[model samples]
Target: MVPPAVESPNPQLTQQFLSSALSQRGPSALPYSEDTKWLIRHHLLSLTTSFPSLEPKTATFTHNDGRSVNLLQSDGTVPMPYQGVTYNIPVVIWLMESYPRHPPCVYVNPTRDMVIKRPHSHVNPSGLVSLPYLHNWIYPSSNLVDLVRALSLTFAADPPLFSQRRAPRTPPSHNPNPNPSPNFDSFSSGSSNPGAFSSGYSRPSIPPNNYPPSPYASGSGRVQPSPTTTTSHHGEDQSEVFKRNAINKLVEIVHGDVVGLRKTREGEMEGLFSVQGVLKQREDQLNKGLKGMRDEMEGLEQQLQMVLMNSDVIEGWLRDNQGKKFRSLENVEDAFECVDVLSKQMLDCTASDLAIEDTLYALDKAVQVGSVPFDQYLRSVRALSREQFFHRAMVAKVRAAQLQAQVANMASRNQHYAV
Candidate 1:
């Protein structure tokens, strides 16, 4: 069927609608991030600008997982060239939550009179479209306009839908009444039912010129019957017609309410999911902090144990020296003996190094005051420096031995604690 021609949408209104739908805070707001929303707006505008036949709008999308989300949708027809003739093929493009990162979902939105062509590689019976471009979609590069163009080309090669043939109606029997009034059947047949159309709008299989121009042809691209063409049934009971109309109105109201409720619930779910993500991040941070605190506590405990052990050793040495009394400075020096032979050697080397440093300082002072000659001063300094170097080397070796001994002692302490 030849799709209805769509008029160019008002730029200001289009922008306004997109802004409202993609607002950060609102019931109608999309789930896209701020940057993504801007990209979506730009992509939609670009598409409509390039192909005026396509119109952007918002709709509810239901996933296979039974989750409902409000998403931006482009519902309209794209121009496809088939066998030297251009035809408009209706389509719907759904921008998912992770759009641009992920490709948009395209579908062949066929009208009620049309049926999907089976065994098609690009299109499935459920109207879901699969194309090479979608498979290799790259972010910030692939866009809605290019996707629509690809769809047009692919559809041109093999159309996704074909018109469903209907059997011809038999001619009505002749009535005896000279003034024949329209019955219920005649009234209903002529009346336009909105439900008769699907996939947004309907298109005639024959040339558009053969039928009357659609009331919405120059407007929103939707097909609506003209008011003038709507005729009242004179023969049918007015009360019965009113009852039927009232029931239909009630049903529509109920349907609208249900849709609104679903959308509200879906919005709540999205909010909850966002809160959950925040909570998960905080939980991870807390866990990391707790582990760090535990490590710090263990280090402090180890330091306290080492300090206590040194205190115990000092107390034992004090007790051991409690009975000893020194009569002279030499005896005091002998009383405070080194803990081991290596410790005594380290102490002797340290003292000799300090003595040499003092001797060098005295020689400098004597030379400055002319008490010592320059040559003598130089010779004395050289001799003192050589002796000091040997003492420092011995001190370094002793310190290395002490460090290794301390490391061994700590390892033993750790092993004891483990036992």
Candidate 2:
């Protein structure tokens, strides 16, 4: 029969499958648990250790230009002293091959760019810290963990780059040339455009007519129209005065518009607040239900995780417990077997004891019959007693050997908990 031809995979389908796989994989699922070489694996964090909040992208050990220098990525919490208050700071320590012999290099991993360099006390231009402990590091005595702790203390005396970047202090109160308001008197500078120098309200221009004394006067209310008034003599009519007064009146309209806007906003806000109370009550009811369900779901998820984690510990405990019980039972069974064997050995001893009893009975019967001589009977009795005594000694030695063998076997098998 002819072999069937194999169908070739469609390139489009292959690409689609790959894309779906990548999407579902989702950034390695647990980045820290990937396969690594033995050298790198040895330095990786244990189950007991807390992982760094900001770990390097790759956990691989870096080699320095093919030299013996190997840099291991380590990150964890370090105790920090910040202004009389102690805080835990995260740091990265690089371990080299000549580890205990040489102090590991350390850096503050605050997770953002900061003023890394000097006049910055402990920290060097390269971002490497120079703590007193690091400078005089004794090969075997000085460790990386303590060195990082010292760097944290150093930061308090010299605040970090970000700490110095606080909001600019409330603007200085002193101003040599205090501008009370825009000088509308100078039209060229102030009235070039309405928007110029307009911070909320514009300064009103000074009126040329300082005539009638009014109740709202800031300074001398009426300056009797200058003795040398020119308007009348220059053929300027009352229309000119009327026009100037009207222009001044426009400034009052600006103030009126501002007041109207403020009132409209306040009224609108009051209406919304009256309606907001009703909506807030309804929102609380719905939110309570939604939040309760969400919390229940989260609680269930956490409970399941806890149970699964406990299962491994439980299994280990059960296995060790079962093993100990089995060993104990085996020892008991062996003891029973040994006792049975010793009992069987003692069968000979029982026979010897019975023989002694029989010899006495025979001696009693002889004395009653007066058939056998008293001397002969006494000689037989002595020989029988001697034989019985010999057998008892031999049996005792054999019984001891049997017990010793059983004890040795148990001790060998249960080496750790042997009695």
Candidate 3:
């Protein structure tokens, strides 16, 4: 007899196993971030605590893109409650590299004696499971425990597997006849050879009584025999039996083809979803770049406006003084006359300060070249700096007075407008 696939929960063992798998380095390392690995370990531990049947292990998972990754897998059975009794349904859950953010891949791992029920709402012919919980998986909130619970609940409503029925064995007759008449039973059973049953499809080692009652069984809790087993050449025409067998074979072929096509389509769809996620990330980046460009364009437009205003002021000044000719330096100074006494004082102070600065620079250069003695250069610099200080102080005072005057003028204009 095969050992039960599920075992009791062992949190300490589970943790140790996960730690060992996750800590592997280099080529054998799990392809998960440090934080993700931690989360995976925690999630598995918690899941095992809740459901002792599911055990964590590592497996190589190949994606639709043909890339193989060593991912953490949880394989065992989940206890599903049906008709007042609980049944263990074998399943394998693969945690993808992008788990938490994306849902894990789940498949119904039926045993040799079990066959996946066709037209199953949640499980596909290829054993892939689709659940609303997986579809609505939310990161940070969804966990392995909850997912397993959902699977159990969904499967309890509609079980995914049914026990495969084997060909019935014929009972030996004790009647001592010299020769046995040929019949449909003898031909169907191939009774000439005692090992014919073993040569044919191998049946489950477990007795029929040990098998769970199939969910597809009728009200009497007995599975209805197939048409081939119930109908015989003795009761039905031989031509009809051959035709039925041919039709069944054709149906099986078509079902297999359909299942293959469906699996291919599902793989293509998964690839498309991955591409869509990549496209969504790129779209977010493009949107951010476009926003930055828009902000930069606005700043540039503002600068351009300021430049245009400054250009207009310079152009107006050039137009106003284009024909005015200065006869001497004094006339040139007069042409750029200040508007007020404070403005005139600021202009004079600024010009005197600049002149003193030039004299100091010349003295420094003269000292550097040894044209002027260091003592004389120092004395001249001291005197010029004293004078420059007074000029700069005067410039500051005049500028402050001018600013105050402008404030008063603006206030008076506002008062007049109010009146």
How much lDDT does each candidate structure score? 0.74, 0.47, 0.73
lDDT (tens digit, per residue) of candidate 1 on 1-419: 46555667898899998887887487656788775677688789878876777899888999999999998899988776554456677889999999966999999887655566667889998999999999999766677877887887787677776653322233456655544343333323433343432212334456633322221132224343322212222344678557645654665566568679999999999999999999999999999999999999999986786677678879999998788768766655776778888899999999999999989999989999999999999999998899999999999999889767866887898999999
Top lDDT: which candidate number? 1
lDDT of 2: 0.47
| Per-residue alpha-carbon lDDT of candidate 3 for residues 187-271, written as tens digits (9 for 90 to 100) | 3443433344234333446564343454433123543332221211134457854664565466556656867999999999999
Task: Give candidate 1 regions above 4 Å deviation.
Answer: 26-28, 168-419
Clashing pairs in 1: none
Per-model TM-score on C-alpha atoms: 0.43, 0.25, 0.43
Name model 3 segments beyond 4 Å from true: 1-7, 169-419
Query: Which model, 2 or 3, shows the larger TM-score?
Result: 3
Candidate that beats the other on lDDT, 2 or 3, i.e. the better one: 3
Q: TM-score for candidate 2, please give it.
A: 0.25
